[model samples]
Structure formats: C-alpha cells, structure tokens
Target: MNKMVKGRIYTLIGAIGWGLSGACGQYLMNDSAVSPIYLTALRMIIAGVFLTILAFFKQPEQFKTLISTPKEMFQILYFGIFGLMLCQLTYLIAIHDSNAGTATVLQYTCPILIVIYVSLKEKTAPTVMEFAAIFFALVGTFVIATHGNPFNLSLTPAGLFWGIISAFTYALYTLLPGKLIYRWGSLIVTGLGLLSGGILFYIGSASWQYTIQWKPYTFIAFIGIIGIGTIFAYTLYLEGVSLIGPVQGSLLASAEPISSVFFSIILLGEVFQGIDIVGIVLILIAVYLITMKEQLQEKHMRIKH
Candidate 1:
C-alpha cells in the first residue's frame, strides 16, 4: 500500500488499540485484585522497560542523541511526568470514580483542548466550523456523562474532575512530542519518556506496597497486551502524525471513542439509547468539521489570492 493507505491503516489500528485500553482496564479492575493506580503504574513501568529495550536495539544513534542533550533529557522528564504519569493517574482516577464509558467520553475533550492550544499558539482565531465541532463534542460529552439524564450531575464529581484533567494532560501529551520526535525520532523519545514514567510509577507502587501477583494467565496476558498494544499504537500514531499532520491525525484518532463504544457494547453489554446514538453522531460530525477547517480555510485563501 501507498503512504496514505498505510497511514490510514495505522490510524485505525491505533484507534482500536486505544479504545481497547478501557476494556482492558475494566477487566483488570474486575477480574484481578489490582487497584487502578497500581495497575496503571505497573503498565507504565513494564511498557517503559519493553520499549526502552526495543529502542536501544533499533535506534542506537537516536538513543545517543537523547543522552547527549540536556534539553532532550528534560523533554523526556517533562513528558514522563506530565504526559505519562499525570495522564495515567488522573485517567485511572476518573475510571475509579466513574464508569469507564463516562471517563472515556470526558477524555475525548482533549481534542477541544488541543484546538484551543493550537489556536492560542498561532494567535489565530478558530474558524466557525471549529467552534461548531467544539460545541458538538461538548454536547456529546455532556450526554455521555449524564447518560441522557439531564438531572444526574451528582453521579461522579471526582471522576469528572479527574477526567477533565486527564483531557488537558492528554492535550499536552499530543502537543509536546511533535518537536521531540522531529529532533530525536519516535523510538528514542517515546522510549525515554516511558522509562521516566515507569520509574515514577515504581516509586508510587513502592510507597503503597503494591505487590505483583504471578498467578493467572489472564492477569499476565493483560499486562503484556496493554503494554505491547500501546507501544504498537503509539508507534503507528507517531508515524501517521508525521505523514499527515496533527490536525488530520487527531481527527482520525477521534474515531477511538467509536471503537470504545463498540467494544463496550460487545464486551460489557452496554447498550446505547437513541439519544446516545444521536450524541455520538453529532460528535462525529463535529470532529469532521474541526478537522476540515484548515482545508476549507486554505480553499478560501486560494480563491481570494
């Protein structure tokens, strides 16, 4: 396949992988005695080790650059703390405080945050379509959070807080790594960031006396699947971003919640009402609008020029 086809395939795989993460988390929470915090922490650590080893072997030169530059070192540390650690901690906290579906929907707010961040950075106003997309996404989030009941705001305040924070952290995560990837390549930067995050999680686990159980193929497989799956997803995601630009990449990634919804229905037996379906449709339309803004704007500019 050509680069475009390859990029789309990668994007789809990444979306599916990310959507499965919630199911995996819920499975671990239900089937095992692991706390979300401990599980997330372990995930960070183990994935870090796995990726670190891979990076060392495959991209030795990039690894050397990472070790050589103080700025690059700081990038790893920053991403580790903010991107990996904060993202996992808050996201898991959201899941614990609320249902996985609710947390997942709230996390989708990251795209809105990303649009705002980019708009601010560029000192340019967002197009009307972008605003419409943000509005649709916000509406979808509200519907999902309320479970279509407008009066049920008291279900999970803590979960909502953490979920919102997780969204912001994710926005930063999306924005921060582009420059680093340009400088050091995806493998080295991602590997180091994972290592730093894992170390921090290890410290947290140590403090809490979180013991790892070595029984049950389910638990063992869960860890490996989540870790390796994420690595594959991230690798593809970075490549897609590089090929297609972040705006299009993020729009493609917004399909993640669709996958999550499908998995939730199949695996967890969660059913969507008519209202929920409508909300999801709106969200999809909104994402399309937001992503197409640049193309639309470029067309208008060409007409004017």
Candidate 2:
C-alpha cells in the first residue's frame, strides 16, 4: 500500500483505540471502587514502562541523546507534567463527569484552539474557512451543552469545564513537543514524557494507597488502557502524521468521536437526543473544514510554486 493509505489506516486504528479507551475509562469509573486518579496513574505508568522499553530497543542512541542534557531533561519533564499528565487527567475527569462521546466531542475543540494560537503567534487574521470552522465549533458546542434548550444544560458544568480544559491542554501537548520530537525522534520523546508524567502522578496521587478488588475485567481494562490505548494509539497516530502530514492525519482522526459515540451508545447504552447528534455532526464538520482548509492551502502553495 501507498504511504497515504497506510497513514489513513494507522490514523483510523489510533482513533478507534482512543475512542475505545474513553468508553473503557467510563466503564471503569462507574465501578465506584475505581478511582480515576489511581487509574490514570497506573495507566500512564504501565504505558510509559512499555514504551520506554520499546524505545530503548528500537532507538537506544536517540533515547540516550534525549536524556543527555539538562535542558532536554527539563523539556521532557515539562512535556510530561503539562502535556501528557494534564491532558490525560482532564480527559478522564471529563469522561467521569459525562459520557465518553460528549467528552471526545468537547476535546475536538483542540484544533480550533490551535488555529487561534497560530493566528496570535503569527499576527495574522484567520482565513475565511477558519472563521467558519470557529463559528461551527462554537455553535456545535452550544448545541451539545444546551441541547437546543437555552435554559437547560445537557451536560454537567463540571463535565463541560473539564472537557474544554482537556482540549486546551491537548493543544499545548501538540505544540510543545515539536522541537524535541524533531531532534530526538517522537518515540523517545513520548516514552520519556510518559514516564516522567507517570512518576509525578504516582507521587502526587499516592496511588499505592488506593485499594481495589481484583476482577478479571479490571485487569483486562487496565491492559487495554495501557497497551492499546496509550502505547499503540500514540505510536500509530504519530507514525500516521509522519507519513501523511498532520492535516490528513487529523482529518482521519475524526473517527475518534464517531467511534466513541458508537461504543458509548452500543456498549454503555448512553442515549443521545436528535439535537445532540446534530451537535456532534456539526463539530465533526468543523474539524473537517479546518483540516481541509490547510490541505487546500498547501495545494494552492504547491500550484503557485
């Protein structure tokens, strides 16, 4: 297969993995006995360990280079704490407060946030398509939150708040690691970041104190969260981005919300109103528009050249 086809497949697999992880997170959280903090800590640690080992085997020199300098160490630590830790924590909290589908949709605002940040950094106005995308994102979010009723909210305030925060942190995650990723390779950087973040989470949460009843499903869920969700998902998604560029990769990742909503409705029996579905569709369209705009701009530049 061509790189584009492989990239799309990888992107789709990554999206499905994340979508499944969100739903599984909700499932685990519903157990009442499972603490979200503890779960997040454990998941990060397990995935970090796995990835670190993989990175060491795959690219030992790059892994060594990543940790060689204090500046690089600090960068990895910062990326871990702010980028990986906060992003995952807020996302899990959002899922705990609301359904997986809603949480995923809210996190879709990251693209919009990225656009805004780039505009501010570059001191340029957004393109017309970008403006339209922003409008659609806002209106879609409003629809999802309010469910077409101005007075009442479909999602809890905490859910909405955390979800937005998740998106913001995700945007930071995307932007903060570009230099390190370029220099040290994405696998090494991500592995180290996850490991550092996981250590911090362990210290902060004192996760060892959390007690849990051992169930088969609990173990399975933990494995799924760590292995498929974090390790495979991040690895595959980054590979896809490298192969096809971020715009097409992101467009393919729209499958995340679709998978999340589908699994939530099917596996968890979550119900969505017509308005909610419409809201989800609009948000997805907004994401597509934003990504497509970039694709078009790239094409136009190529044509001009």
lDDT of each: 0.73, 0.88
The candidate that achieves the highest TM-score relative to the unseen native structure: 2
User: lDDT tens digits, residues 1-305, model 2?
Assistant: 99989988998899888898888788888753677788888887888888888889999887787677889989998998889888888999999999899999999989999999999999999999999999999999999999888899889999999999999999988889989988888878888888888999899889999887666587677656677878899889878878988778888899999999998998789999999999999899899999999899889999999
Residue 16 in candidate 2 has what lDDT?
89
TM-score of each: 0.85, 0.95
lDDT string, candidate 1, 226-272, tens digits: 65457666777767766765656767887777877776677767666
Evaluate residue 219 in candidate 1 and report its C-alpha lDDT on the 0 to 100 scale.
64
Q: After superposition, how far is residue 72 of candidate 2 from its true place, in Å?
A: 0.5
Error of model 2, residue 127, in angstroms: 1.2
**Candidate 1 lowest-lDDT run of ten:** 220-229
lDDT of 1 at 157: 75
Best by lDDT: 2
In candidate 2 the C-alpha lDDT for residue 278 amounts to 92
Report the lDDT of model 1 for residue 304. 100
